[model samples]
Target: MNRRTIQGKYEIFLQKYNEGVKKYIPIYRVKKSIHTWYNAR
Candidate 1:
């Protein structure tokens, strides 16, 4: 039972972390692309 609960918590943490990364990745990519374009100009 204790191990199950710990595993559940770890799973939840990973889900949240993955969601956060997913949300930020697009923003990061957009910013990077814009920076590169402006620098090239």
Candidate 2:
């Protein structure tokens, strides 16, 4: 594979990875907040 093609593939992978992270981060934040509140009690 050429450098350009490899870079393109990497970019696509990064985009998909970011999308997955974005989708899950809110859920993660909610869980983290709940955990912290429970621990604070």
Candidate 3:
């Protein structure tokens, strides 16, 4: 309802989003590498 509360919520949301992305980065990298290898083959 207040500006500070809204900002805090936004920060929390960003933190969770970043963490989720970080967790997925390795999986995505692996998939990308496999795709590239297959394409080269």
Candidate 4:
């Protein structure tokens, strides 16, 4: 795929992932230091 297409897809994927995370987990409860296992798909 082209760079632009890959970038657009990545943004969409990230937005959806963020929304999913917010839906399941409270924003204030998310600790970056404690949750180092989370990785970008």
Q: Write the per-residue lDDT of candidate 2 for residues 1-41, one digit (tens) a residue.
A: 26568789899889999999988877533443455546645
Runs of candidate 1 exceeding 4 Å displacement: 1-4, 27-41
Q: For model 2, give the RMSD to the true fold.
A: 6.2
- The superposed Cα distance between candidate 1 and the true structure at residue 17, in angstroms, equals 0.2
Candidate achieving higher lDDT, 2 or 4: 4
Q: What is every candidate's alpha-carbon RMSD to the true fold?
A: 6.3, 6.2, 6.2, 14.0
Name the lDDT value of residue 1 in candidate 3. 27
- lDDT per residue (tens digit) for residues 1-41 in model 1: 36678889899889999999988877533443455546645
- In order, what lDDT does every prediction score? 0.76, 0.75, 0.75, 0.79
Order by lDDT, highest first: 4, 1, 2, 3
Error of model 2, residue 4, in angstroms: 7.3
How far in Å is the alpha carbon of 8 misplaced in model 1? Answer: 0.1
Q: How many clashes in candidate 4?
A: 0
Candidates 3 and 4 compared: the better one by TM-score is 4
Compose the digit string of candidate 4's lDDT tens values, residues 1-41.
Answer: 36668789899889999999989986565555746577664
Q: Can you tell me which runs of candidate 4 are displaced by over 4 Å? A: 1-4, 27-41
Candidate 3 runs further than 4 Å off:
1-4, 27-41
Query: Model 4, poorest ten-residue lDDT window?
Result: 27-36
lDDT of 2: 0.75
Worst 10 residues of 3 by lDDT: 28-37
